[model samples]
Target: MGCDGGTIPKRHELVKGPKKVEKVDKNAELAAKWKYCALSQEKLRRPIVACELGRLYNKDAVIEYLLDKSAERPNVEVVAHIRGMKDVKVLNLTDNPAWEGERRNAKGDCYEDMHCAMFICPVVGLEMNGKHKFCYLQTCGCVFSDRALREVKTEICHKCGDPFQDEDIVVLNGSKEELEKLQKTMEERRAKAKTGKKSKKSKGVETVSKPSEAKVSSESKPGLTNGESGGDSSSSDSVPGPSSSSKTAKPITAAGSKRSIQQMEEKSEAYKSLFTSHSSAKRTKDQLSNWVTHTPYHF
Candidate 1:
């Protein structure tokens, strides 16, 4: 198979092993179900995780801004204080309060509320300690900490790999026990694989990548792999004509560097001509008093 960006290490490559056709089929079924799981807006009554409790909107905003700035400089962790279980866990109402006041008040509109059970594990990552943690948020929302409040783009946290809630408060670090359990589950799965039996570990809604599916990820474009190295430049040349080259290749000529400026000047001249004609055509009908009314007067 062709490599994408980074070199595909030999270790990650799957060597010949006994095929677990049954498990593969099961995983395929699971993948299909996973696809369907994302299609609905309905909420299930699951365990109430403390992190899903209500959010303090301004606190979240400040935390997110700090996190973006803290990406370059390590060691800073955004920390927040948690009072009790209600603070940690929350019931995610299906009826999003954010959209509340948009329409006219109608009777019995049935804006239902549902809860998603989620929590923040306390285990810290290599870059920072466990002291700075935020509450659980929607997997798509932010988790605040000492460095900054970060939005959890994926279902899992980038650092600790914990599942966030739809509206859960999150701590930066997961509990040590939770990390140990995660590791133990992974180890158990590995061990069970040797015996040709499926592992009993909980799939607990964490996002795990399948090697086969990842090899053909639509999100990862054809020329690029999930790595830092640049993708194939030849594909960049195939678009309509030479335009893609300007988009893909590095700058080599002064003409290329000044192309945008030239385009802007041409656009500005066209706009000026249009405006001049437009004003001159209407100059006779326009009144001086209309413009003078808004002007500041000295006397």
Candidate 2:
């Protein structure tokens, strides 16, 4: 055993170390994020859209997802947050003049550039290949780089000249932290809209009930007057009230019954006895005399 081949092992060789993390190609990652649709994994084309969280997608891909949500898709998680078309904004892109299209290498004659972009920023002339930060206006759908907006600070859009506020700016392809912030802002806006609708409904109900309450009060006024005046017809008739025709009720038999004139405080008792209903108006046959029928001149 006298050290024939140095059989003693080092601690570094005996124990295994953690594996090194693999690095993703930066250029390929950028190409995937900017050039390909998040939902369908297809090449980005005209009428591209960006969601509220700033994830880019093809317009056709989003529509397909909404049409058949039960169908299987490659990237279902990417579109899980999008509920409808309103959650996304169609991008307004500016074409790059120098870059040729897919047929640029039709003859296979020259070098192909993978970094070249189809669109560029209208204000700063920067190619939108994920190297420069870009944002779109929510009001006009115009795209511009962050540098252009920072250098030329104004409320008006540089591309469309339309007026917009700070809240209307939405960044394209934002980071995770930025997306979380955007998600919170969206939820707050929806909550506020719901509260506003509820308040309007309550106001409408109050307005409808006011007329009904006024109608009930008007009908009750005539009843109180009739009770206080001992059913006097003249006094009850003088008070103005709503017409009885509007109510869905038939006239009661008691409504036609009139109080005897003797009960009326306004008329004299002597005048009340002249009515046929009074006891003085009746006479017995034995007590009847014919003196009033004879005229002295005619006799």
Candidate 3:
């Protein structure tokens, strides 16, 4: 065949192949989870905090988000459940001894350690680089590897020596299954707390009701006794004959009657002296004649 205007096809160009699948780097993924804040995606610094779901965050970043949740943020969905500071616990991380933070970044230092860790497990000496499972105590905030805690098997904290229960231990950056289990446990604890409050309230109501009931019964008994005694006295007094009743009724009417003016004057000598009905001293006949003349005309 005659040669065409197009260039010759190479062996590699003629071969058809499937698109390559992009794979995430293990080291980079681990670094993102452990050394960076889950919410802000910044380098982890002091005053780091963790949520109940084991997501890590910077304390300042969380505070800023809480202050103005309506503000635009890069990863707002990551902290949608975080309402306030109570949802997060500040970590008390142990600094790694091998870390040379500022000195390693010096201009003169030729060799830099890429695998340096900022914090480590105090008991197992494991770097917190997402390779091993880690957990923190809610009571003390001390962190340790899961393996170390299982091996040691003590109720007291390895670093602070404070006593702790299984309920107090919270996993950091746990898997989905672990997070679900933690949520269930939290719900159960809250339910128990509510039940306890209800029981106390019921007990208080019972105590108050009992005293009031006793007072009502005691007061009712005295009223009944007084009523019975008064009724008995009234019945006994009513048993008299009609003649005796008439005689008693006549005296009651006489005692309650109003006195006449003549009877009142006869009862008291002081009242009789106020009027001239029985006066020993009388006006003279000449004084009466003068009183009649003085009334008609003045001299």
RMSD of each: 31.2, 17.4, 16.9
Best by TM-score: 2
The 10-residue segment with the lowest total lDDT in model 3: 218-227
Q: Candidate 1: where is the Cα deviation over 4 Å? A: 1-21, 24-43, 50-88, 93-299
Q: Write the per-residue lDDT of candidate 2 for residues 1-299, one digit (tens) a residue.
A: 43368778777777899988999998999999999999899999879998877788989999999999999899899888888999889988899997788899898889988889999988889999998898988888888998998999999888778999988888888888878888898788779988999999999999999999998976655444334646554544655675532231223323346677878899987898889867788788878976674567855
Q: Would you estimate the TM-scores of all the predictions?
A: 0.15, 0.68, 0.64
Displacement of residue 62 (Cα, Å) in model 1 is 34
Query: What are the per-residue Cα lDDT tens digits for candidate 3 across 179-294?
Result: 89988886787689789999999999999999999988755543443246576547646787787556435544554566654467456777655666535346777656643443
| lDDT at residue 219 of model 2 (Cα atoms) | 60
Question: If the candidates were sorted by their lDDT against the true structure, best first, what order would they fall in?
Answer: 2, 3, 1
Clashes of 3: 0
lDDT per residue (tens digit) for residues 175-250 in model 1:
5664455346535644667555423333422225455567566334434432433455545544577776665443
Mark the 10 consecutive residues where model 2 has the least summed lDDT: 245-254
In order, candidate lDDTs are 0.37, 0.83, 0.82
Candidate 3 Cα lDDT to native = 0.82
Residue 148, model 2, lDDT: 90
